[model samples]
Target: MTIAVRTFSQLNEAASAIASDRDAAFFGGGTLIMRGINEGHAHISAIVRTTDAEFRAIRTAGSNFEIGAGATMSDVLANRELSFLHEAARAVGGPAIRNMATVGGNLFARSPYGDFTAALLALDARVAAAGSSGGRETPLADLLRDRERNGHGVISHVSVPRPAGGAEMRFVKVSRVKPKGVSVITIAAYLPLSGSRVQGARIAYGAMAPTPVRVAAVEQALEGKTLDASGVAQALAVATDGTSPASDPIASEWYRREVAPVHLKRLLLGQPA
Candidate 1:
């Protein structure tokens, strides 16, 4: 299939034109799009570039942090204000791939193994989109659900609240090589502590499920608990329970199940996985 490329000087115009054509798509850094075209996974007549969109700025919008759709992973990593996102950005592809993968592209790609989505989930991020109906905000989880349910539209930005209280976070990915190996399991944890007790806890697991999911049961069980070895063990148990991980050439379900609990325990206790 042949794909035609187009450029836009403004986002409103781009959104209007793409909405007029059902098969049209917006291009970002083109890392995923180019690969999909090469692999026969994506075929479309037209591609619209986001270079002219005002979606490249990373700034505070009210109390929430907004990241422009066109912002590259490299840009996010270099921003001192986006420390959590920076950590996640560093875990994306290597130098060249990182330079080419954009935040909006990664979120829309909807790959279950994508590190950025998992990190966003951990941050409780929301996606801002501009479509034929104009613009709106949707929770990241809901957006992923909609993308899976109905493939359409362009993501204009992503917003996340500056976490309140004493927030500590950790990300762990198990792979043979940092850059290319499919992660056996990726875990992201965020803990907001009060005194010696945990005021809030969020744990998200990726590559071990169909999508990045919050370990709600585990999070609830750990909330208000003293951050200790015993609590960590229990949280890990709940976190790994009922996971539906698929076996692939690189790893097995048994291996993921085995590693998940142990890693979760380590992360909750502020120890490295």
Candidate 2:
């Protein structure tokens, strides 16, 4: 069975229904959910679909971004306000898949799949949600760290603040296909620079760990250093340190470790990877 919820109230009702039933789950976009269901996950007997009016919006004003949970990748690509994220959006899928995937669903996606969430993480995004208890806001990093604890609520919105002055936002993904495909490694970052030196940085890498990871050591290494070839080489070397990735068919841990610095170099230098 599946429930289509049109309003927030209806969404709440559907959520209540799922809470009481072990076999039910919230379905967003059907992109990832259907894959699992087809793989013989018969336990998911019902879904609370989020393709209703309540969760379909893309609002951007000034430097603030507010995307509804159900807003699709197509919506993201079309918004000029989100130019910084356009690269990530294009990396999501082809036209049809992009039209079907939702922003909220990407947040809960497991490793190697949610490259867009990696971008959001680097951008310091936050999520707004409503649970039976009440409404709340949580940092995207915190949510990613403890998915189970913060995931049982209905997501109303995802937001990112404007970067500080002189901050440059960038995204890069290494994929088998240029247009539509999963990434071998994806990197997103916001680098705040002062003159020729980096003051701060938020860099997120996907498919390099159990979840998208940000290397604080890399950020610290880059701070107070010029954004030149020498500085980049040094920071890139530090970027791959302290990572934990399991070997997978798509790419081995060694491969990811070896190339992460290369991708990071490209992203930070604004060169195509």
> Highest TM-score among the candidates is held by which one?
1
lDDT minimum window of 10 residues, candidate 1: 144-153
Count of clashes, each model: 0, 0
TM-score on alpha carbons, each prediction: 0.92, 0.90
Deviation (Å) of 42 in candidate 2: 5.2
- Report clash pairs, candidate 1: none
Q: What's model 1's lDDT at 155?
A: 78
Q: How high is the CA lDDT of each candidate model?
A: 0.77, 0.77
On residues 1-273, what C-alpha lDDT tens digit does candidate 2 reach at each position? Answer: 443333224556656666666666777788888887777753566676543465677886467788877888888888887888887887787888889888888888887888889989889898886443444667888777877663456676788786677888888888776666577898888888889788878888888877787888788888888777888777887888767866777788888888888888877777777
What digit string (tens of lDDT, one per residue) describes model 1 on residues 67-104? Answer: 98888899898888888777678777788988888888
Off by over 4 Å in 2: 1-9, 61-63, 132-134, 148-151
Colliding pairs, model 2: none
